[model samples]
Target chain A: MNRNAPGYVLGFMALLCAVFGAGVATVHYATRDMLAANERLNHNRVVCSAFGLPVEGRAPADYARAMEQALVVATVPDGRGGARSVYRRADADPPVVGFTFWGMGFWDRIEGFAVMTADLETLVRLRFLDHKETPGLGARIEEAAFLDQFEGLRPDWTAAPDRRVMIGPAAPTQAGNRVDAVTGATQTSSALMRFLNEELERLRALDWTSLEFEPLPGSEP
Target chain B: MSVRARDIFKAGLIGDNPVYRQVLGICSALAVTNLLANTLFMCFGVVFTATLTNVTVSLLRRHIPKRVRMIAQVLIIASYVMMVDTLIRALNPDIHRFIGPYVGLIITNCIIMGRAEAFAAQNPPWPSLLDGLACGLGYSLVLIAIALVREPMGFGTLLGIPLPARELWWHSWTIMLMPPGAFFMLAILTWIARSRTGAKETSA
Candidate 1:
């Protein structure tokens, strides 16, 4: 049998695909539970961090436990005609809401979670969960120095007609609704601010006052 | 040359070090070395991908058609990389997110393909596996060395451990955190390693 024959080539290719497919499938199936657990752990960590809850050195199970015990999950209209989930503290007197939002960054999409005050105009904390931004540059968005600026920033929709948050050069003395952009990552900063504003606009349109809370699966009420 | 396993291993670790001698996988070495934690995980991913891909390719070398051997090698490498990616995500989601696309980009790292074609294609399975593991180690050693320099200087941390002086007086070098710093570090490291080994420089 000629090694270069079309029959041999096709047969070899088919065999290779089948073998590799099996190998990959086996790994995927084996790790499915661990992967789901890690993902849940990561999401819980982000939500907790956004709400100023301690997460360091804690197990993912612990975060899940904390989230379950303290937060109530609710689905709300995303202002895009679709519903998105938001979490609120089950015990807060006035109730604070938290949600994850996505934005375009320098290299790829950035996802973050933010906790907002009961009035829905003030940010309590914002923490980036995942991003593909260039390391050390746009990736600085995840750094505490950059993200901490969002805390207590009150977005005044009247400041911008479209209701997007304004980000500018570092102004430690400046007040109200404006965040200081990461120095070298102006593009990522602007993109994040733009998306936050857009999401905030949509979030503003939602009726947060009367939303009902439901316990997430596998969580206690 | 009758290649023994030790020689194969030493060749990758030193004689034909991927980063210093062959200069094959500098892309990831530069991109992920700023954080020691990230560099270590990336190394694990590369080692896992390379060794398995090599063993798989060597086992099938005879059956793979000459014209389609590259495609076959790629499929095997990609499959192993996907497996590594899944494992990393499951075990360490934080590092997985930090490295993000670079994990998938391992499929394109030249060191894996270079060994598959240059050494693995004609070698026995065990030897090919050694070669792959050696090359991956060589690449990883270089990355770790660069990370050692970059992480402390750039971020005032070692594997995320904050240096005492960082809080007291030491100011982190911001440039060391950026791409230009990686370029400079890689250049210096390759030069030092090659010069020490008396290896002839190849132009990139």
Candidate 2:
């Protein structure tokens, strides 16, 4: 059996693929539960953060307990054939809704979560999960200075699609929906503004009351 | 260690460094060096992949046909990198979130492939493993040095911890956090390292 022969080469390649494929599969399968738990913890943390719940310095178990006790989950049509999970605060007098939003950024896709008031007219809070923006320039979106602008700001849902929530040079008073964009990050600012406004519009159009929501595990049904 | 192993380590660390000397794997060197945490994880991923890939390639060198060795090497490298990614994602999701975008870059890093092709394909398994590790460490050394400067200057913090008396004297240098900052640091480091090495050779 010549090592260079076609049969030997093919056999070696097949063996290599089988061994490596199986190795990767086994590791992935073994870690599947841990990965899922990590993801759930992150989700709970994000939801907790979005609604201004205490997350910093809290344990993972605390986040889980908070999610189980304070939030309800609903699966809704995403307008793209897939269903997306949305979270609602169980006890907020007027209710608060949170959902993940993502869109193209300066260099890559930026993903974050947005929480809105029950009417979907005011932003409760915004927090990023992942972004590939330039570190000092565009990546500043994650900074409290930038993200805090969205909190308590009302989006003019009646305004045109593109003008619902502006992200640019806000007036000195900082009273309108317009928020100051990060300096020296025009491209990232524009891209964020577009996606965020689009997400706001989508949120406004959704019928929240009609969608069925199941009480989270450990919560009173 | 044997003299031969020492020589391999010396070559990987100083004589034929994958970053400053050989000028390989600059993409990740520049990309992840701005943040110390990111650079550390990137180094771990590269070291894990390079060392394992080298051992695997050397063990199979006799059986692997020359015509298709590249593909086999790649499959091995990719498998190891995937495992590293999975482990990091599972064990430390916070760091994973910060370095996640750059983890996939390990597959294309030239240092791992360069070692597998240049040394591992012909060497014994143990020597090849040493070479891979030395090269990975060489790359790590340069990246960690750059991150040490870049993070402090750019963010006025070390590993996100605010520097003591930061507000009194610290000022953020935005450029230090960008790619151009890496270019400057890499060039300066390479020049200093080469000058010292050149002087050593002349004196010897």
The prediction achieving the highest TM-score against the true structure is: 1
Q: Provide the lowest-lDDT 10-residue window in model 2 chain A.
A: A169-178
Off by over 4 Å in 1: A54-57, A78-82, A90-95, A103-109, A159-163, A167-175, A180-195, A214-221, B1-3, B152-157, B160-176, B200-204
lDDT string, candidate 2, B30-63, tens digits:
8888889889998999888999999999999999
Q: In CAPRI terms, where does candidate 2 land?
A: medium
TM-score of chain B of 1: 0.95
Q: lDDT by residue for model 1 over A109-201, one digit each (tens)?
A: 888889997678688899877788876678878888887888888887676744446787534447587777777888988888778888887
TM-score of chain B of each: 0.95, 0.95
Go through the candidates in order and give each one's DockQ.
0.71, 0.56
Query: Could you give candidate 1's per-residue lDDT for residues B75-169 as a string of tens digits?
Result: 98889888888888888888887786788889999999999999889989999989999999998999999999999999999999999867888
For model 1, how big is the CA root-mean-square deviation?
Answer: 3.8
Candidate 2 lDDT by residue in tens digits, A116-187? 887777888999877888766898898999999898888876778987888886554465688888999999
Candidate 1 clash pair list: none
TM-score of each: 0.84, 0.83
